[model samples]
Target: MSTKTPTEDDILRPIKNTTSKWFVLFGIAGLAFGLFLIGWAYQLMYGLEVTGLSDWGSGGGVTWGLYIGAFIWWVGIAHGGIILSAAVRLLGMERYMPVARMAELLTIGGLSAAGFYIIVHMGRPDRMVTSVLGHYHITVHNSPLVWDVTVITAYFVLTATYLGLTLRYDISRMREDLPSHFSPVYSALTYGYTEEEDEVIERMVWWVAAAIIIMAPLLLHGGVIPWLFALLPTYPAWFGGIQGPVFLSIALTSAISGVIIISAAFTRAYNWDHIITEDVFRGLLLWLGFFCLMFVWFQLQRIITGSFFAGISGTYATQAMLSSVIYVGALAAVMAVLIFIFAQALRPSLFTKTRALVAAVFVLGATLFEKTFFVVEGFQTVEFSIYEGVPGPYFPSLIEMSSVLGTIGMVTIIFLLVSKVVPVVELHAVEHLQEGHEPEQEAPQEVEA
Candidate 1:
């Protein structure tokens, strides 16, 4: 049986086909983003008090709250998504090429959300800019927060450049089919484009991927973000050698889950099931399951180390973990589902796309809950020098919750708008589909070795 090859027209369907459903979706996202801006304005006028965050030594309240938790979550997603995209390209994982551009888009959206949260969390956005710019030379070397800003900014630039370079290739190919309104943007993006430039652009992208692979694990997610928490010895839960790996694992799991959700949505909306095939879903699921398993292992390591005849801080960390029955149960349930899905994969008749998608949803939810719990609970176990009292339970205020919703809305809006402008699916992926390449049957022995 011959598979249908996707033509340039098919690749450019999103640009050519402007449907009511797209308008409705874009409208909803725009509305949510508008509401978010309003909520942010309200926050600015009111102050940080509008949210659940409280300063240390002030009525025995925790400093960081939902915003910081969300900051970490978004940053992790950005880091992991870009890492996956880079890794797939670097490792020659053609099986995932269909979803590579989508993953790259996730990196952009996630980083944008993360940057927005940093501003929102400050409550004084102007001050944040002034302070960073004024003290960059003085604090860049000494401050973890500054270091985080540096790496995140660098990562964002790298990912964006990688995406832009790749887009130039795609846009040049589809320049004729693209809408008239996009002519200016296309010309700007593809300025001085020629057929000979393709190889040069490919080499540039490969080097960028190589740099990202090095920086992501060594400097960004695995270094600065985790160090923000781990370096603080006062918070026993956050401070440890394992914090980096644990955080990286969560990032990967959440990022993979995010890609699965996005791919499924695109498949449903665009009816590109043939291009975004079951093989793509299966590869992502396998990676997600592996990360979820690693997450459980890291949690066990954390629990055992903290609970074995531990001190006040260690005991506090262990107790915090034990007390969160909901978190533990959610993690366990997701793990079990992933395991079952893997089992079903062995027997093709038992496997279903919906099952994998559902598991991805579960992992996404579980990771969010777990990260929030980590942030809140780390603050709860406060090591005070003078004042001594139980810290109050930190419940996010209406404003804080609104901001969360708003940020998510903002991400959706950005993605929807970007999709309208550019092909969500990569041009090379369409060509790959046209070539009718079969999925690899087995791993190479050298790769296995």
Candidate 2:
């Protein structure tokens, strides 16, 4: 056996191994997906009538609050993967190489959930046929909602394609071991080639990079989020022109952190220590650090600008974000303290396992904070009337909560399914490292006397 330590790339390529673990993960996701289907079917059978929503009160449909909120939140979380993959490809950032494939997979998995959430949110889901076929009853010029649909759909396709091609690239390298039955699926996924697929893969990769550069910023416009904010007559915090973009930044920050958590969890679950190398952890930590800073900046900006807008309507919006326990202000404070502590404890070195674990926890907390705020704050921004000239709290009812949880389950299921089929990391990109490519590792090992 060779005694030399392998390069990061060398270990990332999947070995021809299978265990019952994939089934277990898939089973959990499937259960969640099934729950979502139950909720979905219930909504379909009863229509929006089963929900606590009323046009007379607040348009209290499940559509605007939890379903749409989660839709935008998940979409925000997804942008990190898109940005990371596209940025690395464009800038030739080799450090990002280890995680690029997984990042792309994250984009596909997250966005697929976002799409499903949108469909589930439709009050008249049956009318989705008409909407997709190009009928529109609502429109606002330069609406984030419209742009969101366009860009998100594009991303779903582009990221899925990119991931599929990359998976194909990995499978092609393992052609010797791949069974005959799986060959066609592998070839089709890879765009139908064996040897010279690099050129095709490289070109597609750059195209996605370009798309990411353009669409990432556009994707941030709070998309469906601003639409949700617009539902409120009095709430200005979520309605401001800057709110959408600000939320976008928060989304990217959270999504990246979530990816780090997911990566760590999967590695631990599979005991694939070699594949998820220190380099990958290091790269993620660096980004998580930057994310911490950006999140703080965004929160401060919202607070400062929001404070100045302290008239009745503006003040309400500001208070909604700043005072709501579950929403904006508290989470921001927690993130600030946690991130500072994490940054101090974390070193730039990827080899430090204890520090890496701490960093992962920070990223997860910060991202979850950002997402919780997106939903809870958005809910507060909309004003509601209680019985007979009284104002009411914006709590989600039972059905709404169920629906939201169901969509989450759906997202988990889709990603779980994909993981079973595709190599989540790029195999070929790392395989070259094992072929006597790295200088230091090329030397023969001496036997003990």
Candidate 3:
């Protein structure tokens, strides 16, 4: 077994030469992000008044449904990255080593996207500062939002610190001859630093990994999604107890897929030799397959539960999911995810570059749509006394759409910019291979290279 490590020169190559496709991608991302900013500014100046939201129905133009749905999706992606980082570090799995840094980057990026959406979703964005800085005693009855915001912030800080420290260490390894600061302040931030060696970094990685593995899931499943869905009495048929678990599964799946797709795109655009091999993709597919199994079972539970008690609205929301138009979209999306996974698992070789990219995009879209059903569809059915017999229809206006696009555009821009400056794959993986676990080789000899 040989890990063909990329040299410092190879790592530095992308940074030095940004004149080609890199610039183009960044330019597009930037322009889209600028558009988002302008749109958001327009919304802010005119208020939700410029949009379709009415004072009549306790409405802002933006639907909390879409924002919350996307928030969960992004949170899932973030958790997936955290899990990837943690798994690699904990197990010392050399195969996952290449993607550790990549995974961490996704975590930060996805979380940032979710956080921004939270702000835009709010009718009162100005209170965000007060929400963060103001103090209150923690109690079960108190605002879960307070606690959620706190935990999420802490998780972000920890992950960012871990990546920053590791990146600095990677820099030192790639250019040991160069002068760099290791003052007391910097070392403290690096969490009690030592020599910038592969093994040392791995051990440091172990600590960060353990922390992420523990914290991210807690913040996401235990904290965020559950906090939203738990309050509702009228959970749709599709949303069984399995929603949280399934949410976790899809989150990890999408997060990993996003990382893989982004990394592959980076390789193609930059022609970086450090791009992940087929074995990595195969591993990703395997993980995707596992998620597929869970998702399939989750769907089956919904359908069976719904079928068993047809027309039963109060107790079982499953019936609603099976028969509803919204669930039609949700079910189709779920089926697409399953078919994609089955295609990946049954005859793995068929997933070529183009197919894998297609599959990845499909799965992400399906998962996002599924989330839409989970959030928006159920909210419409809640038998609140105030609503009487009339049902709510969540039709997001252009203002909301613009906000959503802006957030996504911002996230894409951030990712593109980061890919240019940061090493997308972990340098430590290469170093570990060079340390005699696997003999080094050139491209012509590698499988799935």
Q: Which has the greatest lDDT?
A: 1
User: Tens digit of lDDT per residue, candidate 1, span 75-132?
Assistant: 8889899889998889988778878988999999999998888778777888666868
TM-score of each: 0.93, 0.81, 0.84
lDDT of 3 by residue, 212-260 (tens): 7776556565446665675554544333465566667777768767876
Lowest summed lDDT across 10 adjacent residues in model 2 is found at 54-63
RMSD of each: 5.5, 5.1, 5.7
In model 3, which regions exceed 4 Å deviation?
Answer: 1-5, 49-63, 138-141, 176-201, 234-240, 314-316, 324-326, 435-449
Residue 399 Cα positional deviation in candidate 3, in Å, after optimal superposition: 2.7
How much lDDT does each candidate structure score?
0.82, 0.61, 0.65
> Compared to the true structure, candidate 3 yields what TM-score?
0.84
In model 3, which residue pairs have backbone atoms overlapping below 3 Å?
1-438, 2-438, 2-439, 237-317, 237-318
Error of 1 at 172 (Å): 1.1
Steric overlap count per candidate: 0, 1, 5
Order of candidate numbers by TM-score, starting with the best: 1, 3, 2
Cα misplacement distance, residue 84 of candidate 3 (Å)? 1.2
